[model samples]
Target: MLTTIVVIFLIVYLGMILGGLPFLQLDRTGVALLGAIALIGVGALSLEEAVAAVHLPTVILLFSFMVVSAQMRLGGFYDWVTHKLAALALGPAGLLGVLIVVVAALSAVFSNDIVCLAVAPVLIDACQKRRLAPTPYLLALACSANIGSAATLIGNPQNMLIGQTLGLSFDGYFLDAILPVSVGLLACWGLIAWQTRGRWTDGAALVPPAALHEARTEAIAFDAWQTTKGLAVAGALLVAFLVAPWPREHMALIGAGLLLMSRKLHSRKMLGLVDWELLILFMSLFVVNHALQRTGVTAHAIALLAAAGVHLDQLGSLFGVTFVLSNIVSNVPAVMLLLPLAHHPMAGTLLALVSTLAGNLLIVGSIANIIVVDAAARRHIDIDWRGYARVGVPVTVVTLAIAGIYLALRLHLATG
Candidate 1:
């Protein structure tokens, strides 16, 4: 039984690293779901146990936010905002700085993945219109989004999971995180601006492919009423998360309900934008990890580490491991695996910050990065790993250092 569980765990994670199995059409989410099914089929977990293994609060909250984000997308708010930001009469460096700031702030409230998906295409068009190279700005969009999402508990999936599972105070986490996140955003803008110093536009800048945009029909007219409604709900939700004592999942669902009762936007359109695959990935990993935990393997592994004087519950050890594992199995699964060892005084904050920040290290590290890259590709703009790493490597290292120092200071203050 133990051998079977270990094999399944290894295969699922292997799939995560390779993005899919050889000769198979499965992605990370499919691989995880298959592992969960294998466990249940092997009687490692019963049907009831599998259902209970899924964390409903995290899933519910994630789904609710998807609905809210969908409303914003369908209302054309992201499109309107990106166009306005890109159209500002500023130099390349100044423009990149502005884009970085706005994208980060927007991502902190909505899911960073969704923020990238909705904003990427619009950003590409905007940059092309201004004869600017879309690559650097797109990289900044992904980098800053990852960094900014660490500022709040509800910013990204991994943060939301850490917050919900650890019972972290929403307002408290924000206060602990805002400083590092802010500095990280500044560093991101500076790095990208420096890297693309002289090459802001292409030689063919004056000639935009009118034929390319002529066939594009993705324009959604800005709906003032819908945009206003979505903004009001998002603002209210943030205030409640900060001050109210109610369960966050319940409050978020209430807000989603309000948005869904819209007169112009149909329920079908709103639901269509939800990333059900991501939710499945979350639930499936929960079941797979729970089954593994029940086998005592997790305890045995921890014992071996402790004996080696490498306790993961320590802030420094966990911080380093989170960076390595996050880029390995991706942040969501990495967080699920390390969550069992989150026992340090500030473990929740460290986990949330490190896991989210580590994503900027590589394109495949986060869904947000993938979304932006794919968007650029459709426009015939290639942003390969090397293209991304020129900026990503430095930005990631700088941001992580900033976060580590801030947390260390907080620890010192409390202990002293």
Candidate 2:
């Protein structure tokens, strides 16, 4: 049973690294779900045990935000915002700066993946319409979104998991994270602006103005009423997270319920935008990781590493491992595997910041990067791995260094 569980765990994480089982057509989510099912089938864990391994608070919090973001998408709020940003009388460099700030701000609140998915296509069309090369702006969007999501616990899935599991204070995390996140956004803007110093126009928008009318975004018109309603709920949820001692998940769930009662938007559309696959991935990883923990291998491995001077409970080790694992198996799964060792003084903050920021290392590092790449491809703008790494590598190095410095200072001051 132990061997079987180990093999399943290895295979599932391999799928995570490769993004799927080779030639099997199964994605990371499928691989994780199958691994859980295999564990149950082999009696490594009972049905009840498998069910209990799931962290419901994280799921509820993630789901509720998905609903809120969906409401924004349905109301065409993202598209509307992108249009407004593009319509500004700014030059390429100026536009990139504004875009970095705006995307980061929105992603800090609405989740980076949702921001990327909803904004990328529209952003591409906007750039093409302006005859600006979409690559730099696209890179900025991806990088800034990842950095910005590190600002708050509710900004990304892994952060939500860490916060709920560790019982982290939402407002407290925000106050600490704002500095690094801001530094990251600034670094993103600077690096991309420097990289694309000369080639800012694509000449693709040379097409007629009338042809440009067919923007790449969905036809969902902006509904001020729906947008205002969603924003109100999001604002209220933010305040509750800041002040109320309530369970963050329950408060978010209540907000989601209120959004579902909309007369203008149907329940189906609102619910449809929720990322069920991501939720399933989270649940599946929880079970697989729990099963592995039961085998005592994780503890044994940690002991071996500690003997070799690799203590993950220390901030430096935690930061380095998260930076590596997040790119390898992706951030969510990486966070799941390392959660047990998150006992350092600043482990929560370190885990959240490094895991999220390191996603900019490669295109496969984060779903937001992939979404942006795919959107650019649809518009005949190619952002290959080399293209992304050009911007991503520097952005990552600068942001991580800034965050490390800040956290180390905080730790030093607190301990002293």
Identify the leading candidate in terms of lDDT: 2
The C-alpha RMSD in Å for every predicted model, in order, reads 1.4, 1.6
Model 2 residue 112 lDDT?
A: 92
Backbone collision tally, model 2: 0
The local distance difference test score of model 2 is 0.91
Worst 10 residues of 1 by lDDT: 202-211
Give the C-alpha miss distance for residue 3 in model 2, angstroms: 0.7
Question: What would the TM-score be for candidate 1 when compared with the true structure?
Answer: 0.97
Q: In candidate 2, which residue ranges exceed 4 Å CA deviation?
A: 203-217
Residue pairs with colliding backbones in model 2 are none
